[model samples]
Target: MPKSWPDQLLQMLLTLAVILSTALTIFIITLPSSYSHFQSGEITEEDFTEDDRQHAGRSGYSYYHNHRDTDGKLKTECTIQIVVLGDIGRSPRMQYHALSVASHGGRVDLIGYVESEVHPDVQRSRFISVVPIKPHPKQLQASNRLLFLLVAPLKVLWQVFSLYYALGYQTKASKWMLVQNPPSIPTMAVAQFVCFFRNTRLVIDWHNFGYSILAMRLGSRHPLVTLAKWYEGLFSQDATAHFAVTNAMARVLKKEWAVEALALHDRPPNHFQPLTSIQRSTFLASLPDTAKYAANIEDGSWRLIVSSTSWTADEDFALLLDALVDYSARAAENERIPKILAIITGKGPLKQYYLNHIQHSKENGKLPNVDITTAWLSAADYASLLGSADLGISLHTSSSGVDLPMKVVDMFGTGLPVVGWSKFEAWTELVQEGKNGCGFDSAEGLTQLLQDLFGDDGQRLKILRQGALEECNRRWDDEWMPVAGQLFQLKP
Candidate 1:
């Protein structure tokens, strides 16, 4: 059926109306601020609590508003904002950015959701102030596909208003804004809008392609996914600068999006360093209801394996479970192979499911010589555990093959040898085949590698540990400062 001339004219008129409305909104955003009355930028010494001061002093983190040189001139060069669309405590990369900025004499206004306990260093830093963003009420219902489809727009709208108020009224004007990009839909667009009006430079840190992640659920050819890809491409083009976790991701941005991005790899912070023998024993003693494992650890009869995960789709703990089960059966047949104590730490949606699976495997007598324990440890405890472990295992298979995992980097930082999942190209950026760590493609391969590494009285493990120790010297500050030093106008 052919449309009438009047109908065609109506459609064209509606399209024109949308274009005009968009232009009007952008024009209004560019105009001078009549909204200054709502903004508050003053902060006094009394504004900080006693506990905050103690945390800062304990961590040796300091902040100053103005300082005079010998000639009595004031200097204030660094003031920036770090925005995260997810939980502030959970996002370790951005937290590292805040620490680096504060250490470099920058005042950071960290904006994000305050759900979990943040790192002690970040919580204590005098130069960093956490600005909380309220999550939409429907956050818990996000897992239900039906509910998510119904309220996704409302959730975005809520964030839009929340971000506007947080950027405009709650925090002070800043020179630059660095935002994470997985939740790019509202974040990238809203950040661009804020930076446009405030005359602030915006930097998008590309952890992964948002649209690719959407494709995991919605599929690649879905109209919504296509629309999301277009939206991400549009908003990302205007960023003042960009950062990527891997060189491959940076190349993708350049070739596909025509945006140049700096490749900034994730390195463990200073707190993730290896612990002393005494410190390791002390940490082990602090754990509750693990006296058997602790006794074996002291006797040097059992080896500890540490692994962490979010229990998400990208990480398959079941692969690790299968490898452990096979290792346990082999160990039961051969007493020369040391007893195994595997500790997996994290909290997530699939945790209970994996717990049941582990119990079932054990009840079936599939794991005779392996003891598996799951726990959620504090940041400091987690570091100590990694440092004390004989080995580390990583099951993260990246959603986008170009993105690397921070968990592997953390394991390397703690001088622990890792056996990583090697299905992705980005894994090569962190794991060297027989150097600092090993990579495996399947449970059988991992089981065989574990036997080879540990069977010879840990002769092979020590060499890998030494290689991992070599990586310890390359800390977060070392990698971060070089690239960010020039971008940010900070003065020491």
Candidate 2:
């Protein structure tokens, strides 16, 4: 089959992009002094002298920071830049990283798009300064599908320029640049160039494989998907260090990608603690939409189940809908089955789609005993909702199958036991079956689990609740300090 002119032109452009990217990578790698010194591991926190400290103080930024105490012990104070391709506010793990750095007397330039309002603590922090990146314009709609080949490159070019400008001009030069992956396209490439020019180290925090995510929309065999994989592997290899969410992901990175990554598990912050009965009651009463549900919950007539989603492709909301329908049918048959107030929070593109489906189900009288509500909550309110809930549900089937869901981590933090999808390998890392939470592979499995958990004599539920409560002790600061803190030369 002979290809069209547009297709031929697109292929040529992609080939050129690959060549240019390869050339830039090679150029960065061959920077003799910078490359050798960066790889040497000679420059460290302990190696910083009094003269170096004085020079760093004068310059306002340094690769190695050491402050002498009254007793003459050297204290570490690192300067770092944390980069996110998505919204800065929505990226909880990266926010935690920034917060951790701030707490340790390290200065951080948090760079990303300013979309939703950030966590209150992050906003209030003096040590953490946000560097906003102007997002690319959405000129072409999804209907212009074929034109995406043209639009996509422009978008990437815009992002590259935006990111480079943000790192180069907007933010202060730092010792280390920690960037989130799964958004591994122009970000890694731009960070690499910035590192090359500035002589700074680059650290990639792997949330998941970006290519696997693209493959969700474009399929595995797609040329773009294959290029993305190659691009990711190439750029990622040159990073100073890597952080993965799960041990499985770390192992995969080492075995498959040949990149050794530290498994820095995501833990909930201190604010995500379990709420008291009084606190839950007050918080629920404050919500206008959930007022009716609140009354039922307070009176012990309805069980509150909390679940959140970005309304993305990896999660199957249809499975949740099917489960709710099955639950409603079972509740009709048995009087022991309690009524449910299911709250699914967070905003995304497919949210309205699911809302429509849920509305249709309600109109059809399919979910008589189950009430589904979608919300976009503030950080505090969202934490309160999790604390108030009787149980949590996770629909995230990871795109890479190796990464764990942060929603489940948040759920565990609030002392709410979860019912997560059992299909993925990373599920075992966070969701401990029959301990803190249960796992289900299908809608039927979810229905049966919900029936058993909620419809029971309250013993099993009590046990899981206790296990969840125990998880509250494992907060983010404690977990982050040793791994991320040490890696970045920030001392608590």
Best by lDDT: 2
Q: Give all TM-scores, in the order shown.
A: 0.88, 0.85
Candidate 2 lDDT score at position 261: 94
TM-score of 2: 0.85
Which pairs of residues collide in model 2? none
Give the Cα error of residue 154 in candidate 2, in Å: 1.6
- Write model 1 residue lDDT over 263-294, tens digit each, in one string: 99999898899888888787777776355588
Residues 1-492 of candidate 2 have per-residue lDDT tens digits of 999999999999999999999998976674323322332222234544465456553222242334434554433346788999999888999998987886666778899999998887776654568889998887833424478666788888889989988888787567788999969889999999888777789999999999999888878999999999999999998899999999999999998779999999999988898998999888888886567778888875688998899898899999999999999999999988999989998878789889999999999999989899888889988999999999999999988999998998898898999998979888888877898999999999999999899898878988899989887779898888889988987656
| Model 2, backbone clash pairs (residues 3+ apart or across chains), number | 0
Worst 10 residues of 2 by lDDT: 34-43
Residue 42 lDDT, candidate 1, scale 0-100: 38
lDDT of each: 0.83, 0.84
